[model samples]
Target: MSLPRQSISPLRQRMLEDMTLRKLSDKTQSAYVRAVRGFAGYLRRPPDTASAEDLRRYQLHLVETGVSPMSVNAAITGLKFFFEVTVERADALAKMSPVRVPHRLPVVLSREEVARLIECAGNDKYRAALSVAYGAGLRTSEVVGLKIGDIDSQRMVLRVDQGKGHRDRFAMLSPVLLQTLRVWWRTAHAQGKLLDGGWLFPGMNRVNPLTPRQLNRAIHAAAQAAGIDKRVSMHTLRHSFATHLLEQKVDIRVIQVLLGHKKLETTALYAQVATEILRQVISPLEGLPPG
Candidate 1:
């Protein structure tokens, strides 16, 4: 059973107001609140009264408790915002430091694996959704957030509004993906599961869009059904898309723009996982002649 939610304290109320004034996204606001709440629970008192030493100890506590580096860093960021912005106690977090998160290459699926995965989806809706994720390199949220009118066949682009970083951009819409979407649309319309100009992927109720969690579950089931061994998620499709494009000799800058990445370095990471490009490289041993 879920525990009863504690009533919001005045300090937390102020923090919420500060976050709202900054126009932080709802997800970010919730994360910040959760981080502060966790900190307060650790202290058994209000977070506003924390000292620099307390902050340091709390960080150490997080590390000792086996929090992942990424989550620990996120908590540190949230606490920094609370102290620096809301509490006006910037010095309180002086001794607290964020942990460095190790960089690891993302998991990518092969083209054939991707095809089999999509084909194994429980239904046509999931199959089309999976296709859009790979075909346009869209995130799962973007896939479910797509609106019927977002498909711009005339311009051959998909209008992605408020994607990651709260930025709007266009994604490539291939002929194959368009046809797949049309088929899904027709099927959904015939089943009365579609609302005009509504979500491309709807939940059981047409009023709500398909959730990221639901899409994630669908992908897991599909992956198991396809008998693919590599870790697969909706994001695996996106990684495969970018890697395949790189293997096809698509410009890194072009892929960056298509992926809506703010930095070229972010898109460049895909090159490390592009097996085809790796295969095409001439080894120094080959130039030295076989022993």
Candidate 2:
């Protein structure tokens, strides 16, 4: 009798298990899985049968189909993991180079634009949430993960524990943010959402942090009401904070530390996109009047 065949590849299942074992972020795991699945679906066969030629064709298809470079790179990364970890065939992937993506500057709001976004918030909770995103240069996740104890008012520092890469860091606290937080705290306390040791922004569960999806929705609604042209998110506030700081001549290294970037290259990109820097440069054609 023939042995039973499984539907999903065991190797792919193992990869998922490995990601969990390593404590990888859920977002990363989901992305990796989706990318890998895309490759598998294209081949219509198991990943073990996929070849360099197959990958090459996929790259061409992505470009021809007008797929963004970012998405293409993600597929390449997922394939690399399958070959390197599961199949133990790193040599097969050595010659492959992912398409080079042009550096796209992040979309950041002006100070006035940020204020307009905050003013559009219908509720105090969302306004306070966004204020923290701007005031501390915090990611949405960090803002939601905050606890009452994280606010060090005396020292004027906010402690961020085990953020990206499971590392801890401190961010400067703005008096304006602190005052808003105090008011929000009182409100949460009245709602019985603030526990002795729990998330500052609680959701359905008292101890768990507020969901990122909820924050994203609130930001989108606020942006729409504010009549801002640019796309905005909780992350946009952070980008605005960094870009504004770079405009003020703050060093890239300092920005890196504050933004919790592990690489200088990551932080350097903001310098290329700072509005103030762009504004200061006199266009080469400015001296020549239009004919």
| TM-scores for every predicted model | 0.96, 0.86
Error of 1 at 59 (Å): 0.9
Q: Candidate 2: what lDDT?
A: 0.84
- Give all candidate RMSDs, comma-separated: 2.4, 4.6
Candidate 1 lDDT over 176-262, as tens digits, reads 999999999889999999889999999989999999999999999999999998899999999999999999999999999999999
The 10 consecutive residues of candidate 2 with the worst lDDT sum are 1-10
lDDT of the structure predicted as candidate 1: 0.93
Output the lDDT of residue 182, model 2.
90
Give the runs in model 2 whose Cα sits over 4 Å from its true position: 1-9, 277-291
Where does candidate 1 clash, by residue pair?
none
Candidate 1: TM-score? 0.96
Residue 26 CA error for candidate 2 (Å)?
Answer: 2.5
- The clash count for each model shown is 0, 0
